[model samples]
Target: MNRLNEQFEKYLLDNLPKSKSFHPHFEKALQQMLVAGGKRFRPLLVLSVTDALQPLLLRNALPVAYAIELLHTYSLIHDDLPVFDNADLRRGMPTLHKTYDEVTAILVGDALNTHAFFLLADAPLPADTKVEIVKELAREGGIEGMIIGQAIDCWFEKKKLALDELKFLHIHKTAKLIAASLKIGAIICNEKEIAKKLYDFGIDLGLLFQIQDDLIDALQDDTKAGKTTSNDENKNSFVNLLGIDGAMKSADELVEKLETGLEAFDTKLKNNLKKILNNYLYRHKNL
Candidate 1:
């Protein structure tokens, strides 16, 4: 699995480029951030959906997978900016704004945002399919999705939100892209029925993921988390609203809910998806 991850990372690195004589500083920062990898979890979902369906499908899904990762990284770079989270570290290294200048970080993030769509638009797939992919990405990553989620997050800081509102915030901010990743993969194979099922699965998985991330930030060390921790005091997080044990229990319930939803799909895909979610959740329990 790690080898597959390495190969996917290389694929992104190989494709990432700029004119040789063009501005190098911002481009260099973008490259460095991409190299300082995370779990590649978003891309993995795209690839895994295709792999579980059929390995050959990876060729069709790879570009979309890479685009999702690029878009996600773009969000991270901006999220860590001084005006946003002001995070100093990411992936165990100084954040883009910290390593480079804030100006460079902003531009690198802008470049990644536009570049992600360019990749999706250029993906080697049927024209109709490519168009749908682009639309899905925009819907998930744009104002109706991740962007709005961020706005809500910023607006709600230091203010308590209802549980449903909190779920809405995360479902759009964090889960939409993940849901889109799987949906895009299934669309590559024209598997709409299955895609919807996996999309729901992705949303549930994302909810669990954000909850775990919140718990980690509230309970773990920066050194262990590869980024700052104990920063959720005023943020809209599961920890603040649900408390630690309540958040854990809610996450477990979500896992069970997802498992039930997965039963609507093929048994094999359902089982594999559950196993992946379980593994990721299991590892974080220690964090």
Candidate 2:
């Protein structure tokens, strides 16, 4: 995973767009956000599934993986905007809107969003495959998915959300894109059934990830989290709604379910996934 992450980071740096006639500051702002470190988990999901199916095709899937990262980054930028979460920090640095002007941050997010589609469209894959990938991403990232989830999150601020409601909010906002990442890789390899199974697995994984994040925000400080803590105080989160212990229980159950889901895959793929889950669980043991 570390090696793959390094390779993906290099690919991103090499392929990211540069300003032509635009002001240097515009390019700088975009570059700054891109270089700011992140987990790059979504793109890794793309690579992982592709690696399992066809290692040779992993090269061809690079653009799609990068596209997911770009879209994820764009969402982060916007999510930290004053109009949204009003966050001041991200990845241990000032949020984009704080480092640059709000307008610059907004434009940078827009640019990244469009560039993600451009990368997907320009990838060296079949047109039909590209279209399918694009459709999945658009659906997951657009109003029907993440956007609506954001809307609900913001609109219901200060109001407690029920457990089911919280699940609905995150399944679309967080899980959908994650599920799409796996499905996109599966689609690229012509593994439709695997795509479906992976999508289901991704839903559980995404919810577990979100629950862990909520615990981090509630328990850890800013430095440990590498971002602002307590930002979800008034937002809907497993920690806020379910309490830390309950959220941990939920995460444990999800992990068990995710592990069980891996039974559908071959031994090699299942082992790879178990490694991922084990690493994650080990890292968050303190939580």
Candidate 3:
């Protein structure tokens, strides 16, 4: 995974979006969140799955991985906008809006969002495979997925949603994209038998990720979390809906479920998935 992260980072640097604009910082802002760094969770999922099933295709899969990162980073930029989370920090650095300006931040997010698909369109993969990758990305990260969840989240601030409703929000906002990452990798590798199963696992894994993030937001300060903390006080978060204790229990249950599910996968795929998830699978429990 370390090797993969290094390779992906190199790819990101090599393929950064280029522009020469009158504005001084447009291009820089567009690449800021991505280069500043985060967990790289979604892209790693794509790479890990690809590596496990078809090692020879790992290099070709980098573009798909990068596209997911671009899309994910765009979401973070928009999520930090004044009208949204209004967060000043992300990935351990000042958010684009804070470092530059709100307008710059907004436009950067839009550019990154559009460029995600552009990367897919320009990848070296075959036409049909690229189309399938595009479909998964669009379905999971588009209006039916993250956008609607973001809409619900912004609209329902300070209002308590039902437990199921909260799950729906996070599933759409977080899980769908993560699931799409895995499924897209399977599509890239022609592993149809395993794609749906990996996607299902990704949904639960993404929920677990959100739950853990909520726990971190509750317990860790900005310096520790590398982002704004205690920011979900008014939003529907796992730690808010379920107190810290209840949220911990929920995480525990998910950890057990995911571990059990891991056992069902073929040994090689299971090992590969486990390598990527070793410390992360139960991160909240340590808190």
Candidate 4:
């Protein structure tokens, strides 16, 4: 896992947009956000799917993986803006808006968002395949998906959200992009059935992740989590909607469901995915 993360980081640096000398500050902001240490979970999903189906295609899948990371980074930048979450920290450092100006932060996010598509457009895949990949990403990351989820979250802040409503919010906001990562990788290999299965798996995995995040926020302080904690105090989170005990119960159920979903996969793939799920469980044992 460490080696895979190292390789992905190198590839990301190599493919990152070059900074113009005249616009050094603008480029610096973008670079800083990208370099801010993250788990690179989304890209790993893309690579893992490809590795399971066709390791030979991993080289060709690099661009797609990078594009997903770029898109995820853009969303983080925007999510931290003053008008949004007004977050001060991300990836254990000052957020883009806090490090730079609001305008710069916004443009950096815009650049990264559009540049993600640029990477996809320039990938070695066939035109039809590229189109499918682009359509999936755009729909998942756009209004029909993440945007709507964010809108609902902000629109209903400070209000109690029912369990189903909270699930709907997260399914679009967090799970869609995650599901896209897996689906895009399967699409790269032309495995439609596998893509759908991975999508289903990703949805459960994403929800589990979000629930764990809420638990962390409620239990840990900012120093422990490496970012602003308690930020969800006013937001509709699983920890808020469901009591901590209830959220923990939900997470256990999700883990069982996710494990069962992998039964149809080959042993190697199932083991690889189970490793990831177990890592998540280990990290949030308090839950």
Model 4 whole-model lDDT (C-alpha atoms): 0.87
Candidate 2 similarity to native, TM-score: 0.96
C-alpha-based local distance difference test score of model 1: 0.83
User: Who wins the TM-score comparison?
Assistant: 3
Candidate 1 shows a clash count of: 0
Model 4 deviation from the true structure expressed as Cα RMSD, one decimal place: 1.4
Query: What lDDT tens digits, residue by residue, belong to model 1 across residues 1-287?
Result: 55446668778878874635467575688677788878788887777777778767777677888888889999999999888888988999999888878998998888888988888888888899988889898998999889999999999999999999999999999999989888887888878888888787788888888998998998888898998778778899988999999998888888778767877777657655655565675555675
lDDT of 2 by residue, 25-101 (tens): 88888777778878888898888788888778989999999999999999999999999888888988999888878
Clashes of 3: 0
- Candidate lDDT values, in order: 0.83, 0.86, 0.91, 0.87
> Superposing all C-alpha atoms, what RMSD in Å does each candidate have to the true structure?
1.7, 1.4, 1.0, 1.4
Where model 4 places Cα greater than 4 Å from the true spot, the runs are none
- What's the CA RMSD of model 2 in angstroms? 1.4
List TM-score per model, in order.
Answer: 0.94, 0.96, 0.98, 0.96
Model 4 C-alpha lDDT per residue in residues 11-86, reported as the tens digit of each score: 9888777658686588889888778768888898888778778778888899999999999999999998999899
- Rank by lDDT, highest first: 3, 4, 2, 1
The model with the greatest lDDT is 3
Candidate 3 local lDDT, 1-287, one digit each (tens): 48888899899999998778798889888878888988888999999889888989999999999999999999999998889998978999999999999999989989988999999999889999999999999989989889898999989999999999999999999999999998998999998989999999999999999999999999999998999888999999998899999999998899899999999988877887888898698788677
